[model samples]
Each structure stands twice: as C-alpha cells, then as structure tokens.
Target: MIYIQLFFSFLKIGLFSVGGGYAAIPLIQSEIVNGHGWLSMQEFTNLITISSMTPGPVAINSATFVGLRIAGLPGAVTATLGSIFPAVILVSLLSLIYRKYKGTTAIDTVLGCLRPAVVALITAAGLSLSQTALWGELPVSLSSVDWTNALLFLGAFFILRKWKWNPILVMCLCGAGGLISFLTGKFF
Candidate 1:
C-alpha cells in the first residue's frame, strides 16, 4: 500500500511538473509534506536543498529520497520509476510531433506561452524557499527573521547578477561561511 501510494504520488508529480525540477518543488512539497504528512516543511526544505545540490533532476532525486525515507530501497525504485515514466512517454511523443511541426506558428506560439508560466512556477518556488530561509517557518513573525541570512541572500544575489560568478563557487563559499558561522555559534 505504501509503495502504491508512493508510485502514484510521484506519478502525479511527474505528470504535472511541466517546466522542470525547480517547478516541481511546490508540487513535491504539497504532496509529501501537506498531503501525505510524511515530511514536515523543514524536512521538505532540506530535501530540496539536498536534491538541488546533488546531480540528476531535483524531482527524481526527491522521489528517491522521500521513498527511501518512507519505505526503503524498493520504495526508492518504485518512486523513481514512477517519476520518470511520464517524462519518458511524453517526451517521446512530443519529440515526434515537434520534429513534424518544427516551424509551425502553433508550435511556436504554444512554446512562447509556456515560457512565462514556467518562469512563474520557478519564481514561486524560489519565493517559497526564500521565505523559509529569510523568515523562519510558516506563520512567520518578524522577530524570527535571520538578518545574517538575509544579508547572505542579498550578497549572493548581487554577486550572481552583477558579476556572474559561477554559481557552484558561490554556493561553496556560502557553505563554508555557514560552517564557520555554525562553529562560532552565529546561528544560535
């Protein structure tokens, strides 16, 4: 029963997560954290962090992690297969049609329309995570704000947009900073 549930939950996630893995964050959060009560918001956030930092698509990684956490190795395999199944079928069909209709106005227009929606989904995911990062958990109070994190967020954003630093390097630098801060008791 748990394996079946994991498969379908991830199947839904895979089916509707049109834009990319980033766009799937909210859906993943909604399913596992809100719907199933399998993981808390903080755990979801950490899952997201681990998923994004590691290789492979975030959704796939998330499925594996969530499944493993919930059930075990069999669950991990089930969830992963479910997650990729839709993409595999859809991409195959879409590729065929795209090749056939490569230059048509309908195709171009549809693609153009989808671009904004994908951007919106990605933005929403980022904002949701940003709230957790800057302001602590939900039902957020101003007093819960982490000023250091806010500063780090702004600094990272500035560096990325202004100087175009390699994102990996910035992330590594931030991780080091976080570690040092932790050792020095800045987080407490």
Candidate 2:
C-alpha cells in the first residue's frame, strides 16, 4: 500500500509537471510533505539539497530517495519507474508528430508561456523551504530566525557573485561550514 501510494504520487507529478526536473520540486514537496505526510518539512529540504548535489536529474533523484524512505529498495524502483513513465510515453509519441508542429508558432507560444510557470513552481518550493528554515514549525511566531544562517547565506551569495567559483566547490565549502557550525553548537 505504501509502495502504491509512492508510485501514484510520483506518477501524478511526472504526468502533470510540465517542465523538467526543477519544475517538479513544488509538486514533489507538496506530495511528500503536505499531501501524504511521507516526509517532514526539513526532510523535504534535505532531499532537495541531496538531489541537487547528486548526478542525475533532481526529480529522478528525489523520487528515488523518497521512495526508498517510504518503502525501501522496492519503493525506490517503483517510484523511479512511475516518475519516468509519462515522459517516456509522451516523448515517444510526440517524436513522431514533432516535425509537423516543430515549425508552428503555436508550439513556440505555448512553450514561452510554460517557462514562467515552471519558474513559479521552483520559486514556490524555495519559499516553502524558506518558511520552514526561517520560521519554526508552521502556525508559529517568526520571532526567532537563525541569525547565523542568515549571515552565512549572505556571505555565500556575495562570494559566489564576486568569485564566480564552481558550484561544487561552493557546496563543499558550505557543507564544511555546516559541519563546523554543528560541531560548535551554532547549528543543530
């Protein structure tokens, strides 16, 4: 039953999420955190972080992790297969007719419209995580924001802008900083 839920939830996300991996974040978060209660808000944020850092697309990685969390290895397989099903079917079918509409202005216009919607979805996911990190649990006062995190975020943003360093290096540094902070009682 849990496996079925995981498969169908991800399958719905795959079917309806119009854009690529990042675009699925909002829906995946909603399913994992809000809809099914499969993951906590913090877990969802961690999932996003881990997914972004891993090799494959964010959506696939997340589906696999969430599925594993829910029902172990079998759930992981089920969720991954479910998530890719829509894309596989649609792309295969569309490939045959793609040439006919490839030159159409309508196709272009639809995609142009879709771009912003995808951005909005990604933005919403970030906002949800921001709320979780900045404020305590939901339905609570926002009196105690983590000042240490605020400072680190600002510092990282400016450094990234100025240095234009590789993202993997930045992530590594952040991870190290987080570990140090945790050790020092600034975090945790």
Candidate 3:
C-alpha cells in the first residue's frame, strides 16, 4: 500500500512537472510535504538540497529520497520508476510530435508562453526554500533566523553570481562551512 502510494504520488509529480526539476519543487512540496505529511518543511528543504547536490534530475532524486525515508529501498525503487515513467512516455510522444512539427509557429508560441510560468514556479520554490532556510521558526521572529545559513546563502550567491563558480564546488564549500561551524560550536 505504501509502495502504491509512493508510486502514484511521484507519478503525478512526474506527469505534471513541466519546465524541469526546479519548477517541480513546489509540486513536490505540495504532494510530499503538505498533502501527505511525509516530511516537515525543514526536512523538505534539506531534501531539496541533498537532491540538488546529488546527480540526475531533482524531481527524480527527491522522489527516491522521500520514498526511501518513508518506506526504505523498495519504496525508493518504486518511486523512482514512477518518476521516470511519465517522462519516458511523454518524451517519446513529444519527440514524434516535434519531428512532425519541426518548425511550427504553434510550438514556438507554446514554448514562449511556458517560459514565464516556469520562471514563476522556480521563483516560488526559491522563495519558500529561502524562507525555511533563513527563518528556521515560524512567525518570522528576528531571533529565529539562522544567521549561518543566511551568510552561507549570501556568500554562495555572491560567489556564484560574481565569479560564476561551479555550483557543485559552491555547494561543497557551503557544506564544509556548515560542518565546521557545527563541529566548532560557532553557529548552527
């Protein structure tokens, strides 16, 4: 039953996760965090970080991770298969359609229209994640903020934007900073 649930949850996620993985974060959060109560907001944010840090698409990685957390290895496999299944079918059909309508204006118009919505979705995901990261507690109190995370977020953003540092490297550096801070009791 859990396996079936995981499968269908991710199936919906994969089927509707247009504009790739980042855009799918909100949908993942809705299904996994809000609807199912499988993971808390903090855990979901951490899951996003871990999913992004690892290889492959974020949506698929998130499906595997969440499934594993909920029901172990079998759950992971079931969820991953669910996540990929829709993509496989859709891509195949879309490929055929694209080949047939190679340079159609309708295709261009559809894609052009989708771009803004995708951006909006990504922005929404980012804002939610930022809220969770910067303000660890509710009510948005001043003392509830995680200063270390805020610093890391700012510094990482600066370095990535200013110097175009490799994202993996920035992730590693921020991770190391967090680890060092935790180990030394400097900040959490």
Candidate 4:
C-alpha cells in the first residue's frame, strides 16, 4: 500500500512538474511534505540539498531517496519509474508533434509562453529553497535565522559575482568553510 502510494505520488509529480526538476520542487514539497506527511519540511530541505549535490535531476534523486527511506530498493525503483514516466511519454509525444508541426506559429507561440512560466517555476523553487536553506522554515522569522549561513551566502554571492570564479570551486570552498565553522563552533 505504501509502495503504491509512493508510486502514484511521484507519478503525479512527474506528470505535472513541467519545466524540469528544479521546477518540480514545489510540487514535490506539496506532495511529500504537505499532502502525504511523509517528510517534514526540514527533511525535505535536506533532501533538496542532497539531491542538488548529487548527479542527475533533483526530482529523480528525491524520489529515489524518499522511496528508499520509505520502502527500500523496490520502492526506489517504482518511485523513480513514476517520476520519469511522464517525461518519457510526453517527450516522445512532443517529438512527434514537433516534427509534424515544424513550422507552425501556434506551436511557436505555445513554446514562447511556456518559457516565462518555466522561469517563474524555477524562481519560485529557488525562493522556497532559500527560505529553508537560510532559516530552516516557512514564514521566515528573524529570530530563527542562521546568521552564519546568511553570511556565507552573502560572501559566496559576492565572490561569485566579483571574481567570476568557477562555481564548483566556490561550492567546494563554501563546503569547507561550513565544515570549519561547524568544527570551530562558529555556526549556530
């Protein structure tokens, strides 16, 4: 029963995610955190962090991790399949349709409209993650804010913008800085 739920939940995420994995974060949060009560917001935030750090899309990574936590290997398989099924089917269909309507204005207009929507989805996901990443919750209150994390974020932003450093290097440096801060009892 849990396996079925997991599969269907991820299937829903896959079907309507639209605009890739980052865009799916809100849906994933809604389904797992709000709808299903499977994971806490903190756990979901951690999942997003882990998903981002690892290979592959965040949605698929999240599905695999959450499934493994819920019901082990078989659950992971089912959840992953569910998460990818819609994309596979839709892309296959779209490819054929796009080929048929190679020069149609309607299709072009549809794609143009979707671009802004995708941007909005990605932006919303980023803002949502920022709340968790910086404050660890929704309806962010100043009292709960982590000053260390906020400082690191500002520093990272500054260096990235000013020096135009490689993102991977910046990430590594930030990770090291976080570890050092934690070890030195600087981060609270």
Candidate 5:
C-alpha cells in the first residue's frame, strides 16, 4: 500500500510537471511535505540541495530519497520509476510528433512561446528554494539570518561570475569547505 502510494504520488509529479525537474519542486513539496508530512520544509530543502549536488534529475533523486525515507527500497524503486515514466512516454510521443511536424510554423510558434514559460517556472522554483536555503523557517529578519550561509552564497556567486569556474569544481570546493567548517565547529 505504501509502495502504491509512493508510485502514484511521484507519477503525478512526473506527469504534470512540465519544464523539467526544478519545476517539479513545488509539486514534490506539496505531496511529501504538505500532504503526507513525511518531511519537514528544512528536510525537503536539504533534499533539494543533495539532489542538486548528485547525478540525475532533481525530481528523480528527490523521489528516491523520500521514498526510501517513507518505505525503504521497494518504495525507492516504485517512486523512481513513477517519476521517470511520464517523461519517457512523453518524449517518445513528442519525438514522433516533432518529426511529423518538422517544419510547421504553428509548432515552431508553440515551442517558442513555451520557452519563456519554462524560464519562469525554473525561476520560481529557484526563488522558492532560496527562501528555505537562505533562512530556513526563521522570520525574515537580519538577526534570524544565517550569516555564514549568506557569506558562502555570496562568495560562491562572486567566484563563479568572476572566474567562470567549472560548476562541478565549484561544487566540490564548496563541499570541501563545508566539511572543513563542520570539522572546525565553524558551521552549525
């Protein structure tokens, strides 16, 4: 029964979440956090962080993590499968349709219009995640802020913009820095 619920929940996420994984964050949050109460907002935020740092889509990673937390390995498999199934089917269908309408102006126009909407979805997801990542559930006041995290974010943004470093390298460096901070009791 748990496995079935996990599968269907993620299946809903995969089916309706257009514009990719970031766009699915809100849906995933609603199901696992708000609906099921399986994870708190902070836990969900951490899940997103971990998902971003790992391979595969954020939606798949999140489904697997949440499923494992909820119902072990079987739940993980079911949720991961559910999260990918719609994408696989939709892409297959879209490929055929795109081939058939390869040069149609209507199709081109539709695709062009979708681009901005996708961008907007991604931006909204980022903003939603930022609220948690930057301040957790604390009130939006200067005294309640995590200054270390804010500093890290600013430093990372500056370095990335100035040096255009490889994103993987930046992530690794930040991970190492975080580990060091943890070991030294500088970050909590």
Candidate 6:
C-alpha cells in the first residue's frame, strides 16, 4: 500500500522533473503534503531541512524519509529505487541522443529555461524550511530568528564562497545543529 504509493509518486517525480533533484522538491512536497497526506506541513519542512543536510539528492532523501516513516526500511529502499530508476533509464537513453543534439538550439533553449526554474525550486525549499523553523507559536518574525542559526548560515555562506570547504563539513554542521535543536526541545 504505502510502498506502492511511494513508488508511483516518486516515479512520476523522477520521470517529469527535468532539471534534477532540486527541481523535484515541489513535486515531492505536493505529493507528501497534499496528495497522500503522509506528512504535515511542518513535518515536510523538517524533512527538507534534514534532506538538505544529508548525503544524497533531496528528492531521494525525501522519498526515503517518507517511506521510512510510513513502513520502515523496506519502504525506504522501494521509494529510493523508484525515484532513481527513471533518471537512470533516461540518462542512459540520452547518451544515444547526445551525439545528434549536443549543440542544437533545442537543447540550448531547454537548458536556459530550466535554470530559472531550478532556482525557484531551491528558493521555495528554503522558504518552506524557514517558515517551519521560525514562526512557531512565539510570534517571532525574521528579525527575531535564532542568532545561532543566523550565524551558522552566514558563516557557511561566506566560507562556501571564499574558500573550497568540503560540502560534507557543511552538512555535518547543519546536522549537528538540527540534532541539538531537536534534543533541547525534546528533553529540556
């Protein structure tokens, strides 16, 4: 049941999401939040945050998270494989077309169109995560955001731009912050 749903949902996303994993965020969010009702808006936000700080593409990480939540390890594998299958097949086939269309205007136009859409999807993911992280019942606004988060975000941005920091380190820091925040809220 859940496995089948996960497969179908991610397969659709994998098949139609043209720009890659980030571009699939909106579709994944809609399916998880609206179509299946597997996760609440807040949960989806947390899932995006967690996924971004993990080692894989957001779409697959998201599918894995939702699948694990719904049915456990088996569900995770099923969802991940489903999400990957279409990309694997498509890319393999595209190799056959590359020789014919590598420098064509059609490919150029498609690439140009996809760039802005990818930016929009990434921005939407950030906005969703920000809304969930802040704006709890406390009535705080952006100016009242946690200073630690602000500092971390700024530091990460600066470091990423000025130097070649390993992405794994950035992910580790974010994951640590999420764990600390979650634990403090849970036990303290």
The per-model lDDT (C-alpha) reads: 0.92, 0.83, 0.94, 0.91, 0.87, 0.78
Q: Return whichever of 1 and 5 wins on TM-score.
A: 1
TM-score of 3: 0.96
Arrange candidates, best lDDT first.
Answer: 3, 1, 4, 5, 2, 6
Candidate 1 minimal-lDDT segment of 10 residues: 179-188
In model 1, the clashing pairs are: none
- Error at 30, model 6, angstroms: 1.2
Clashing pairs in 5: none
What is candidate 2's CA lDDT for residue 145? 76
**Model 1 misplaced regions, further than 4 Å:** none
Off by over 4 Å in 4: none
Of 1 and 4, the candidate ahead on TM-score is: 1
Clashes of each: 0, 0, 0, 0, 0, 0
Model 3 clashing residue pairs (backbone): none
TM-score, each model?
Answer: 0.96, 0.90, 0.96, 0.93, 0.92, 0.77
Off by over 4 Å in 2: 139-142
Candidate 5 positional error at 123, Å = 1.3
Worst 10 residues of 6 by lDDT: 129-138
Model 6, total clashes: 0
C-alpha RMSD for every candidate: 1.3, 2.0, 1.3, 1.5, 1.7, 3.7
Relative to the true structure, candidate 1 reaches a TM of 0.96
lDDT of 6 by residue, 1-188 (tens): 87898888888878877777767777887888879899887788778778877788888898888888988999989888888999999999988887779899998898789899888877886666565555532466766566556656666778788996997797687668767867786211
Q: Write the per-residue lDDT of candidate 2 for residues 72-97, one digit (tens) a residue.
A: 99999999988999989998987877
Residues 103-182, candidate 4, lDDT per residue (tens digit)?
89999999999999889999998888788878986567999888888888888899999999987788788889889999
Model 5 lDDT per residue over 1-188, tens place: 89888999999999988888888888888898999898999999889989988999999999999889898898899999999999999999999999999889999999999889878878887877777767878577767776667767777888899999888888787778777877887764
